[model samples]
Target: MIEVPSRVSVRDLAKVFQDGEARVEAFAQITLEARPGEFLCLVGPSGCGKTTLLRCLAGIETPSAGAIEHRLEPGAPGAEQAMVFQQHGLFPWLTVEANLHFVLRESPVPRQEHDAIVQRLLERVGLARFRRFYPYQLSGGMNQRVALVRAFCVQPQVLLMDEPFVFLDYQNRIVLQDLLLELWQEQRQTILFVTHNINEAIALGDRVLVMPGTAGPFAREISCPFGRPRDVVQLRTNPDYQRIVVEVTQLLRQEQEHSLREGRIG
Candidate 1:
Protein backbone atom coordinates (compact mmCIF):
# COMPACT_ATOMS: atom_id res chain seq x y z
CA MET A 1 0.00 0.00 0.00
CA ILE A 2 1.02 3.56 -0.66
CA GLU A 3 1.64 6.00 2.20
CA VAL A 4 0.96 9.73 2.48
CA PRO A 5 3.58 12.46 2.46
CA SER A 6 3.99 15.56 4.59
CA ARG A 7 3.50 19.20 3.56
CA VAL A 8 5.89 22.00 2.48
CA SER A 9 6.72 24.84 4.85
CA VAL A 10 8.44 28.04 3.80
CA ARG A 11 9.44 30.29 6.64
CA ASP A 12 10.98 33.77 6.60
CA LEU A 13 12.44 33.28 3.16
CA ALA A 14 14.54 36.04 1.57
CA LYS A 15 16.53 36.47 -1.63
CA VAL A 16 18.86 39.22 -2.76
CA PHE A 17 20.69 39.59 -6.05
CA GLN A 18 23.59 41.92 -6.72
CA ASP A 19 23.71 43.83 -10.01
CA GLY A 20 27.10 45.51 -10.09
CA GLU A 21 27.09 48.16 -7.34
CA ALA A 22 23.40 47.79 -6.54
CA ARG A 23 21.86 45.24 -4.19
CA VAL A 24 18.38 44.20 -5.27
CA GLU A 25 16.13 42.57 -2.72
CA ALA A 26 13.86 40.33 -4.72
CA PHE A 27 11.93 38.87 -1.79
CA ALA A 28 11.96 39.08 2.02
CA GLN A 29 10.40 37.23 4.92
CA ILE A 30 8.02 35.22 2.76
CA THR A 31 6.13 32.68 4.87
CA LEU A 32 3.78 30.17 3.33
CA GLU A 33 2.73 26.54 3.56
CA ALA A 34 1.60 24.16 0.85
CA ARG A 35 -0.31 21.12 2.01
CA PRO A 36 -0.42 17.87 0.13
CA GLY A 37 -2.77 17.83 -2.85
CA GLU A 38 -3.25 21.61 -2.69
CA PHE A 39 -3.27 23.95 -5.68
CA LEU A 40 -1.62 27.25 -4.73
CA CYS A 41 -1.35 30.22 -7.11
CA LEU A 42 1.08 33.10 -6.81
CA VAL A 43 0.01 36.26 -8.68
CA GLY A 44 2.02 39.42 -8.98
CA PRO A 45 3.28 42.16 -11.26
CA SER A 46 5.99 41.56 -13.88
CA GLY A 47 8.93 41.73 -11.48
CA CYS A 48 7.49 40.96 -8.08
CA GLY A 49 9.91 38.04 -7.48
CA LYS A 50 7.41 35.35 -8.46
CA THR A 51 9.93 33.43 -10.49
CA THR A 52 12.64 34.01 -7.91
CA LEU A 53 10.51 32.50 -5.21
CA LEU A 54 9.74 29.51 -7.45
CA ARG A 55 13.44 28.98 -8.06
CA CYS A 56 14.07 28.98 -4.33
CA LEU A 57 11.36 26.38 -3.80
CA ALA A 58 12.83 24.23 -6.56
CA GLY A 59 16.25 24.30 -4.79
CA ILE A 60 17.79 25.70 -7.97
CA GLU A 61 18.64 28.94 -6.17
CA THR A 62 19.75 29.13 -2.58
CA PRO A 63 18.03 31.80 -0.54
CA SER A 64 20.01 34.70 0.85
CA ALA A 65 18.23 34.07 4.19
CA GLY A 66 15.58 31.92 5.88
CA ALA A 67 14.47 28.42 5.02
CA ILE A 68 12.26 26.44 2.63
CA GLU A 69 11.65 23.06 4.19
CA HIS A 70 10.03 20.12 2.48
CA ARG A 71 8.57 17.65 4.97
CA LEU A 72 8.53 14.44 3.04
CA GLU A 73 8.16 10.83 4.11
CA PRO A 74 11.28 8.91 5.00
CA GLY A 75 12.84 7.04 2.04
CA ALA A 76 10.55 8.95 -0.30
CA PRO A 77 11.65 10.48 -3.61
CA GLY A 78 13.65 13.33 -2.04
CA ALA A 79 10.82 15.84 -2.28
CA GLU A 80 10.19 15.29 -5.95
CA GLN A 81 9.52 18.71 -7.48
CA ALA A 82 9.24 19.42 -11.20
CA MET A 83 9.05 22.84 -12.82
CA VAL A 84 7.31 23.92 -16.02
CA PHE A 85 8.54 27.31 -17.16
CA GLN A 86 7.20 29.97 -19.57
CA GLN A 87 9.44 28.57 -22.29
CA HIS A 88 8.53 25.04 -23.36
CA GLY A 89 12.20 23.98 -22.81
CA LEU A 90 11.80 21.02 -25.15
CA PHE A 91 14.65 19.46 -27.11
CA PRO A 92 14.24 20.51 -30.75
CA TRP A 93 16.29 17.51 -31.92
CA LEU A 94 14.32 14.94 -29.96
CA THR A 95 10.77 13.73 -30.58
CA VAL A 96 8.05 14.21 -27.93
CA GLU A 97 8.44 10.62 -26.75
CA ALA A 98 12.19 11.01 -26.40
CA ASN A 99 11.81 14.21 -24.37
CA LEU A 100 9.44 12.57 -21.92
CA HIS A 101 11.65 9.52 -21.65
CA PHE A 102 14.65 11.72 -20.90
CA VAL A 103 13.09 12.88 -17.63
CA LEU A 104 11.95 9.38 -16.66
CA ARG A 105 15.41 7.94 -17.22
CA GLU A 106 16.77 9.98 -14.32
CA SER A 107 14.44 8.26 -11.88
CA PRO A 108 15.61 5.35 -9.70
CA VAL A 109 12.94 3.08 -11.13
CA PRO A 110 13.90 0.12 -13.30
CA ARG A 111 14.43 0.51 -17.05
CA GLN A 112 11.42 -1.69 -17.86
CA GLU A 113 9.09 0.78 -16.10
CA HIS A 114 10.25 3.67 -18.29
CA ASP A 115 8.17 2.70 -21.34
CA ALA A 116 4.95 2.38 -19.33
CA ILE A 117 5.39 5.76 -17.67
CA VAL A 118 6.21 7.54 -20.95
CA GLN A 119 3.34 5.94 -22.84
CA ARG A 120 0.80 6.71 -20.12
CA LEU A 121 1.86 10.34 -19.86
CA LEU A 122 1.75 10.80 -23.64
CA GLU A 123 -1.82 9.54 -23.80
CA ARG A 124 -2.87 11.61 -20.81
CA VAL A 125 -1.59 14.84 -22.40
CA GLY A 126 -3.29 14.09 -25.75
CA LEU A 127 0.07 13.71 -27.45
CA ALA A 128 -0.08 10.01 -28.33
CA ARG A 129 -0.43 10.63 -32.06
CA PHE A 130 2.25 13.34 -32.08
CA ARG A 131 4.72 11.37 -29.95
CA ARG A 132 7.07 10.99 -32.90
CA PHE A 133 7.04 14.73 -33.77
CA TYR A 134 9.89 17.05 -32.82
CA PRO A 135 9.48 20.34 -30.97
CA TYR A 136 9.57 22.43 -34.16
CA GLN A 137 6.84 20.32 -35.68
CA LEU A 138 4.28 21.22 -32.98
CA SER A 139 2.47 24.48 -32.24
CA GLY A 140 3.36 26.64 -29.25
CA GLY A 141 0.50 25.26 -27.24
CA MET A 142 1.33 21.68 -28.22
CA ASN A 143 4.95 22.18 -27.26
CA GLN A 144 3.84 23.41 -23.87
CA ARG A 145 1.73 20.27 -23.58
CA VAL A 146 4.86 18.22 -24.19
CA ALA A 147 6.62 20.11 -21.45
CA LEU A 148 3.73 19.44 -19.13
CA VAL A 149 3.89 15.74 -19.96
CA ARG A 150 7.61 15.69 -19.30
CA ALA A 151 7.14 17.27 -15.91
CA PHE A 152 4.35 14.89 -14.92
CA CYS A 153 6.15 11.76 -16.07
CA VAL A 154 8.48 12.04 -13.11
CA GLN A 155 5.49 11.76 -10.75
CA PRO A 156 6.64 14.74 -8.75
CA GLN A 157 5.22 15.33 -5.30
CA VAL A 158 5.32 19.08 -5.80
CA LEU A 159 4.85 20.76 -9.18
CA LEU A 160 6.11 24.30 -9.77
CA MET A 161 4.79 26.24 -12.74
CA ASP A 162 5.78 29.75 -13.82
CA GLU A 163 3.44 31.28 -16.40
CA PRO A 164 3.09 27.97 -18.19
CA PHE A 165 0.15 29.16 -20.31
CA VAL A 166 1.10 32.76 -21.06
CA PHE A 167 2.19 32.16 -24.67
CA LEU A 168 -1.05 30.54 -25.82
CA ASP A 169 -3.95 32.43 -27.37
CA TYR A 170 -7.19 32.83 -25.44
CA GLN A 171 -8.87 29.76 -26.97
CA ASN A 172 -5.87 27.52 -26.49
CA ARG A 173 -5.33 28.79 -22.97
CA ILE A 174 -8.86 27.84 -22.00
CA VAL A 175 -8.60 24.38 -23.52
CA LEU A 176 -5.23 23.73 -21.91
CA GLN A 177 -6.45 25.05 -18.59
CA ASP A 178 -9.21 22.46 -18.59
CA LEU A 179 -6.80 19.74 -19.55
CA LEU A 180 -4.36 20.81 -16.81
CA LEU A 181 -7.09 20.70 -14.20
CA GLU A 182 -8.03 17.18 -15.26
CA LEU A 183 -4.40 16.05 -15.07
CA TRP A 184 -3.89 17.66 -11.65
CA GLN A 185 -6.94 15.89 -10.28
CA GLU A 186 -5.73 12.58 -11.55
CA GLN A 187 -2.23 12.98 -10.12
CA ARG A 188 -3.17 14.77 -6.85
CA GLN A 189 0.18 16.58 -6.74
CA THR A 190 0.78 19.69 -4.69
CA ILE A 191 1.06 22.47 -7.26
CA LEU A 192 2.44 26.00 -6.82
CA PHE A 193 1.69 28.02 -9.96
CA VAL A 194 2.86 31.58 -10.64
CA THR A 195 0.98 33.72 -13.13
CA HIS A 196 0.26 37.38 -13.84
CA ASN A 197 -3.30 36.70 -14.99
CA ILE A 198 -5.91 37.23 -12.27
CA ASN A 199 -8.65 35.24 -13.97
CA GLU A 200 -6.30 32.36 -14.58
CA ALA A 201 -5.26 32.33 -10.94
CA ILE A 202 -8.85 32.21 -9.73
CA ALA A 203 -9.74 29.52 -12.21
CA LEU A 204 -6.86 27.22 -11.21
CA GLY A 205 -6.02 27.82 -7.55
CA ASP A 206 -7.41 26.68 -4.23
CA ARG A 207 -5.64 29.67 -2.66
CA VAL A 208 -4.20 32.77 -4.31
CA LEU A 209 -1.26 34.76 -2.95
CA VAL A 210 -0.88 38.28 -4.37
CA MET A 211 2.52 39.94 -4.55
CA PRO A 212 2.59 43.59 -5.43
CA GLY A 213 5.33 45.81 -6.85
CA THR A 214 8.77 44.81 -8.15
CA ALA A 215 10.23 44.30 -4.68
CA GLY A 216 9.59 42.43 -1.43
CA PRO A 217 7.27 39.50 -0.67
CA PHE A 218 3.59 38.82 -1.21
CA ALA A 219 1.20 41.45 0.10
CA ARG A 220 -1.84 39.30 0.80
CA GLU A 221 -3.23 35.80 0.71
CA ILE A 222 -6.80 35.00 -0.36
CA SER A 223 -8.47 31.68 0.24
CA CYS A 224 -10.80 30.48 -2.51
CA PRO A 225 -13.46 28.16 -1.13
CA PHE A 226 -14.96 27.47 -4.51
CA GLY A 227 -15.67 23.78 -5.08
CA ARG A 228 -13.68 21.57 -7.41
CA PRO A 229 -14.42 20.53 -11.03
CA ARG A 230 -14.86 24.25 -11.69
CA ASP A 231 -16.41 25.12 -15.03
CA VAL A 232 -14.89 28.22 -16.61
CA VAL A 233 -18.28 29.41 -17.90
CA GLN A 234 -19.98 28.97 -14.55
CA LEU A 235 -17.09 30.60 -12.67
CA ARG A 236 -17.18 33.67 -14.96
CA THR A 237 -20.82 34.11 -14.04
CA ASN A 238 -20.28 33.50 -10.34
CA PRO A 239 -20.42 36.59 -8.19
CA ASP A 240 -17.78 35.38 -5.75
CA TYR A 241 -15.25 34.87 -8.49
CA GLN A 242 -15.84 38.35 -9.87
CA ARG A 243 -15.52 39.90 -6.43
CA ILE A 244 -12.18 38.19 -5.75
CA VAL A 245 -10.83 39.23 -9.14
CA VAL A 246 -11.79 42.84 -8.55
CA GLU A 247 -10.24 42.78 -5.11
CA VAL A 248 -6.98 41.25 -6.36
CA THR A 249 -6.81 43.76 -9.21
CA GLN A 250 -7.27 46.62 -6.77
CA LEU A 251 -4.51 45.29 -4.54
CA LEU A 252 -2.18 45.01 -7.52
CA ARG A 253 -2.98 48.56 -8.60
CA GLN A 254 -2.17 49.84 -5.14
CA GLU A 255 1.20 48.09 -5.21
CA GLN A 256 2.05 49.55 -8.62
CA GLU A 257 1.30 53.02 -7.39
CA HIS A 258 3.37 52.47 -4.28
CA SER A 259 6.32 51.26 -6.34
CA LEU A 260 6.10 54.25 -8.68
CA ARG A 261 6.10 56.65 -5.75
CA GLU A 262 9.13 54.97 -4.20
CA GLY A 263 10.97 55.08 -7.51
CA ARG A 264 10.25 58.76 -7.90
CA ILE A 265 11.43 59.44 -4.34
CA GLY A 266 14.75 57.68 -5.01
Candidate 2:
Protein backbone atom coordinates (compact mmCIF):
# COMPACT_ATOMS: atom_id res chain seq x y z
CA MET A 1 0.00 0.00 0.00
CA ILE A 2 1.23 3.47 -0.82
CA GLU A 3 1.58 5.97 2.03
CA VAL A 4 -0.41 9.24 1.96
CA PRO A 5 1.31 11.68 4.26
CA SER A 6 -0.53 14.50 6.08
CA ARG A 7 0.15 16.96 8.90
CA VAL A 8 -2.43 18.54 11.27
CA SER A 9 -1.90 21.87 13.00
CA VAL A 10 -4.46 23.25 15.48
CA ARG A 11 -3.99 26.75 16.88
CA ASP A 12 -5.76 28.55 19.73
CA LEU A 13 -8.72 26.24 19.30
CA ALA A 14 -11.88 26.89 21.27
CA LYS A 15 -15.37 25.43 21.13
CA VAL A 16 -18.67 26.52 22.67
CA PHE A 17 -22.14 24.99 22.54
CA GLN A 18 -25.54 26.47 23.15
CA ASP A 19 -27.66 25.23 26.04
CA GLY A 20 -30.99 27.07 25.86
CA GLU A 21 -29.98 30.69 26.57
CA ALA A 22 -26.42 30.08 27.68
CA ARG A 23 -23.13 29.14 26.04
CA VAL A 24 -21.03 26.35 27.51
CA GLU A 25 -17.32 26.11 26.82
CA ALA A 26 -16.10 22.64 25.98
CA PHE A 27 -12.48 23.63 25.36
CA ALA A 28 -10.51 26.78 24.65
CA GLN A 29 -7.13 28.21 23.70
CA ILE A 30 -6.01 24.75 22.61
CA THR A 31 -3.00 24.61 20.35
CA LEU A 32 -1.19 21.49 19.18
CA GLU A 33 0.52 19.85 16.23
CA ALA A 34 0.37 16.25 14.97
CA ARG A 35 3.30 15.30 12.78
CA PRO A 36 2.81 12.86 9.93
CA GLY A 37 2.34 9.24 11.06
CA GLU A 38 2.44 10.24 14.72
CA PHE A 39 0.28 8.55 17.38
CA LEU A 40 -0.96 11.31 19.67
CA CYS A 41 -3.39 10.55 22.50
CA LEU A 42 -5.64 13.04 24.26
CA VAL A 43 -6.44 11.96 27.85
CA GLY A 44 -8.69 13.82 30.22
CA PRO A 45 -11.80 13.55 32.40
CA SER A 46 -15.36 13.78 31.06
CA GLY A 47 -16.43 17.11 29.49
CA CYS A 48 -12.80 17.90 28.78
CA GLY A 49 -13.67 18.52 25.09
CA LYS A 50 -11.49 15.63 23.95
CA THR A 51 -14.20 14.30 21.66
CA THR A 52 -15.24 17.84 20.69
CA LEU A 53 -11.71 18.68 19.63
CA LEU A 54 -11.47 15.50 17.63
CA ARG A 55 -14.70 16.32 15.82
CA CYS A 56 -13.41 19.79 15.03
CA LEU A 57 -10.24 18.32 13.61
CA ALA A 58 -12.27 15.90 11.51
CA GLY A 59 -14.24 18.86 10.04
CA ILE A 60 -17.46 17.41 11.50
CA GLU A 61 -17.90 20.31 13.91
CA THR A 62 -17.20 24.00 13.42
CA PRO A 63 -15.13 25.53 16.17
CA SER A 64 -16.35 28.77 17.69
CA ALA A 65 -12.81 30.10 17.43
CA GLY A 66 -9.33 28.99 16.27
CA ALA A 67 -7.85 27.37 13.20
CA ILE A 68 -6.99 23.83 12.04
CA GLU A 69 -4.73 23.33 9.08
CA HIS A 70 -4.35 20.08 7.18
CA ARG A 71 -1.50 19.61 4.72
CA LEU A 72 -2.10 16.56 2.54
CA GLU A 73 0.45 15.39 0.03
CA PRO A 74 -0.52 15.81 -3.60
CA GLY A 75 -2.56 12.92 -5.01
CA ALA A 76 -3.71 11.89 -1.54
CA PRO A 77 -6.98 9.97 -1.57
CA GLY A 78 -10.14 12.06 -1.21
CA ALA A 79 -11.11 10.12 1.89
CA GLU A 80 -7.92 11.21 3.60
CA GLN A 81 -9.49 11.03 7.06
CA ALA A 82 -11.84 8.67 8.98
CA MET A 83 -13.17 8.46 12.50
CA VAL A 84 -14.02 5.58 14.87
CA PHE A 85 -16.62 6.33 17.50
CA GLN A 86 -16.99 4.97 21.04
CA GLN A 87 -19.99 2.96 19.92
CA HIS A 88 -19.44 0.25 17.34
CA GLY A 89 -21.53 2.13 14.70
CA LEU A 90 -21.93 -1.11 12.76
CA PHE A 91 -24.94 -1.73 10.56
CA PRO A 92 -27.39 -4.11 12.21
CA TRP A 93 -28.59 -5.33 8.81
CA LEU A 94 -25.15 -5.86 7.29
CA THR A 95 -23.04 -8.96 7.91
CA VAL A 96 -19.42 -8.60 9.06
CA GLU A 97 -18.00 -8.97 5.55
CA ALA A 98 -20.75 -6.83 4.11
CA ASN A 99 -19.98 -4.09 6.62
CA LEU A 100 -16.38 -3.99 5.49
CA HIS A 101 -17.46 -3.91 1.86
CA PHE A 102 -19.61 -0.87 2.61
CA VAL A 103 -16.53 1.15 3.52
CA LEU A 104 -14.40 -0.14 0.65
CA ARG A 105 -17.15 0.67 -1.81
CA GLU A 106 -16.59 4.35 -1.08
CA SER A 107 -12.83 4.16 -0.81
CA PRO A 108 -10.21 4.53 -3.55
CA VAL A 109 -9.71 0.74 -3.66
CA PRO A 110 -10.56 -0.70 -7.06
CA ARG A 111 -13.64 -2.90 -7.52
CA GLN A 112 -11.70 -6.07 -8.40
CA GLU A 113 -9.43 -5.67 -5.37
CA HIS A 114 -12.25 -5.13 -2.84
CA ASP A 115 -12.78 -8.81 -2.11
CA ALA A 116 -9.05 -9.42 -1.71
CA ILE A 117 -8.66 -6.43 0.60
CA VAL A 118 -11.59 -7.51 2.73
CA GLN A 119 -10.35 -11.07 3.00
CA ARG A 120 -6.82 -9.98 3.89
CA LEU A 121 -7.96 -7.60 6.64
CA LEU A 122 -10.46 -10.07 8.10
CA GLU A 123 -7.85 -12.80 8.16
CA ARG A 124 -5.24 -10.55 9.74
CA VAL A 125 -7.63 -9.81 12.64
CA GLY A 126 -8.84 -13.45 12.80
CA LEU A 127 -12.37 -12.51 11.72
CA ALA A 128 -12.36 -14.30 8.39
CA ARG A 129 -14.64 -17.06 9.64
CA PHE A 130 -17.13 -14.55 10.99
CA ARG A 131 -17.66 -13.02 7.57
CA ARG A 132 -21.27 -14.11 7.38
CA PHE A 133 -22.11 -13.17 10.97
CA TYR A 134 -24.27 -10.15 11.64
CA PRO A 135 -23.24 -7.53 14.16
CA TYR A 136 -25.75 -8.82 16.70
CA GLN A 137 -24.14 -12.24 16.37
CA LEU A 138 -20.76 -10.91 17.51
CA SER A 139 -19.58 -9.88 20.96
CA GLY A 140 -18.92 -6.24 21.88
CA GLY A 141 -15.19 -6.79 21.39
CA MET A 142 -15.63 -8.31 17.95
CA ASN A 143 -17.87 -5.47 16.88
CA GLN A 144 -15.25 -2.95 17.92
CA ARG A 145 -12.61 -4.83 16.00
CA VAL A 146 -14.85 -4.74 12.95
CA ALA A 147 -15.22 -0.98 13.34
CA LEU A 148 -11.46 -0.63 13.58
CA VAL A 149 -10.53 -2.59 10.45
CA ARG A 150 -13.38 -0.96 8.60
CA ALA A 151 -11.58 2.36 9.07
CA PHE A 152 -8.23 0.81 8.24
CA CYS A 153 -9.59 -0.81 5.08
CA VAL A 154 -10.36 2.66 3.79
CA GLN A 155 -6.62 3.41 3.97
CA PRO A 156 -7.20 6.86 5.44
CA GLN A 157 -4.33 9.31 5.77
CA VAL A 158 -5.57 10.43 9.20
CA LEU A 159 -7.54 8.37 11.73
CA LEU A 160 -9.51 9.93 14.59
CA MET A 161 -10.58 7.57 17.35
CA ASP A 162 -12.90 8.42 20.25
CA GLU A 163 -12.34 5.87 23.00
CA PRO A 164 -13.25 2.84 20.87
CA PHE A 165 -12.57 0.39 23.73
CA VAL A 166 -14.23 2.32 26.52
CA PHE A 167 -17.25 0.05 26.72
CA LEU A 168 -15.53 -3.35 26.68
CA ASP A 169 -14.45 -5.47 29.63
CA TYR A 170 -10.79 -5.40 30.70
CA GLN A 171 -9.70 -8.51 28.80
CA ASN A 172 -11.52 -7.58 25.62
CA ARG A 173 -10.26 -4.01 25.78
CA ILE A 174 -6.66 -5.18 26.03
CA VAL A 175 -7.14 -7.62 23.18
CA LEU A 176 -8.54 -4.90 20.89
CA GLN A 177 -5.77 -2.53 21.94
CA ASP A 178 -3.14 -5.02 20.81
CA LEU A 179 -4.94 -5.55 17.54
CA LEU A 180 -5.17 -1.77 17.00
CA LEU A 181 -1.47 -1.32 17.70
CA GLU A 182 -0.58 -4.08 15.25
CA LEU A 183 -2.55 -2.47 12.46
CA TRP A 184 -1.26 1.02 13.32
CA GLN A 185 2.35 -0.13 13.31
CA GLU A 186 1.86 -1.51 9.83
CA GLN A 187 -0.12 1.42 8.36
CA ARG A 188 1.31 4.33 10.39
CA GLN A 189 -1.58 6.76 9.74
CA THR A 190 -1.48 10.07 11.57
CA ILE A 191 -3.87 9.40 14.48
CA LEU A 192 -5.60 11.53 17.10
CA PHE A 193 -6.94 9.18 19.79
CA VAL A 194 -9.08 10.25 22.74
CA THR A 195 -9.15 8.25 25.96
CA HIS A 196 -9.63 8.74 29.68
CA ASN A 197 -7.54 5.67 30.50
CA ILE A 198 -4.04 6.71 31.50
CA ASN A 199 -2.54 3.25 31.12
CA GLU A 200 -3.92 2.91 27.62
CA ALA A 201 -2.50 6.34 26.74
CA ILE A 202 0.99 5.39 27.95
CA ALA A 203 0.72 2.02 26.25
CA LEU A 204 -0.16 3.40 22.82
CA GLY A 205 0.83 7.04 22.51
CA ASP A 206 4.18 8.31 21.21
CA ARG A 207 3.18 11.40 23.23
CA VAL A 208 0.31 11.91 25.67
CA LEU A 209 -1.56 15.26 25.93
CA VAL A 210 -3.72 16.04 28.95
CA MET A 211 -6.65 18.50 28.64
CA PRO A 212 -8.13 20.41 31.57
CA GLY A 213 -11.92 19.61 31.10
CA THR A 214 -12.92 23.23 30.50
CA ALA A 215 -11.94 25.69 27.74
CA GLY A 216 -8.18 25.45 28.12
CA PRO A 217 -5.09 24.20 26.30
CA PHE A 218 -3.35 20.93 27.13
CA ALA A 219 -2.21 21.03 30.73
CA ARG A 220 0.58 18.52 30.38
CA GLU A 221 2.55 16.65 27.76
CA ILE A 222 4.59 13.46 28.33
CA SER A 223 6.71 11.63 25.79
CA CYS A 224 6.76 7.86 26.12
CA PRO A 225 10.16 6.40 27.06
CA PHE A 226 9.27 2.86 26.12
CA GLY A 227 10.15 1.71 22.61
CA ARG A 228 7.61 0.84 19.93
CA PRO A 229 6.26 -2.60 18.92
CA ARG A 230 5.12 -2.24 22.51
CA ASP A 231 3.69 -5.13 24.48
CA VAL A 232 0.73 -3.44 26.19
CA VAL A 233 0.30 -6.39 28.58
CA GLN A 234 3.93 -6.46 29.69
CA LEU A 235 4.23 -2.66 29.93
CA ARG A 236 2.93 -2.78 33.49
CA THR A 237 6.05 -4.64 34.60
CA ASN A 238 8.45 -2.00 33.37
CA PRO A 239 9.64 0.39 36.05
CA ASP A 240 9.76 3.30 33.61
CA TYR A 241 6.20 2.56 32.56
CA GLN A 242 5.07 2.60 36.19
CA ARG A 243 6.83 5.89 36.81
CA ILE A 244 5.24 7.62 33.82
CA VAL A 245 1.85 6.27 34.87
CA VAL A 246 2.32 7.84 38.29
CA GLU A 247 3.31 11.16 36.78
CA VAL A 248 0.31 11.21 34.46
CA THR A 249 -2.02 10.08 37.21
CA GLN A 250 -0.91 13.01 39.34
CA LEU A 251 -1.41 15.44 36.44
CA LEU A 252 -4.94 14.13 35.85
CA ARG A 253 -5.74 14.27 39.56
CA GLN A 254 -4.79 17.90 39.67
CA GLU A 255 -7.03 18.67 36.74
CA GLN A 256 -9.84 16.68 38.31
CA GLU A 257 -9.49 18.60 41.54
CA HIS A 258 -9.48 21.92 39.73
CA SER A 259 -12.63 20.99 37.85
CA LEU A 260 -14.30 19.90 41.07
CA ARG A 261 -13.37 23.06 42.93
CA GLU A 262 -14.64 25.17 40.05
CA GLY A 263 -17.87 23.11 40.05
CA ARG A 264 -17.34 22.07 36.46
CA ILE A 265 -17.69 18.44 37.52
CA GLY A 266 -19.96 17.08 40.22
Cα-based lDDT for every prediction: 0.84, 0.89
The number of the candidate with the highest lDDT is 2
Please give, for residues 1-266, the per-residue lDDT of candidate 1 as tens digits.
Answer: 87554477898888999889988787788888888989999987666688999999998899999988877645554227799999999989999999988777876555787798888878887789998999999999999988988887777888999999999999888888888888888887889999888999998899999875746566899988789888865798888999999999999888767667756211
How well is each residue in 117-176 modelled by candidate 2, as lDDT tens digits? 889999999999999999999999999999999999887888999999999999999999
- Each model's TM-score, in the order given? 0.92, 0.95
List the lowest-lDDT window of 10 residues for candidate 2.
71-80
Number of backbone clashes in candidate 2: 1
* Candidate 2 residue pairs in backbone clash: 28-215
Q: Candidate 2: where are CA atoms >4 Å away?
A: 1-6
Q: What is the TM-score (0 to 1) of candidate 2?
A: 0.95
Residue 176's lDDT within candidate 2 is 93
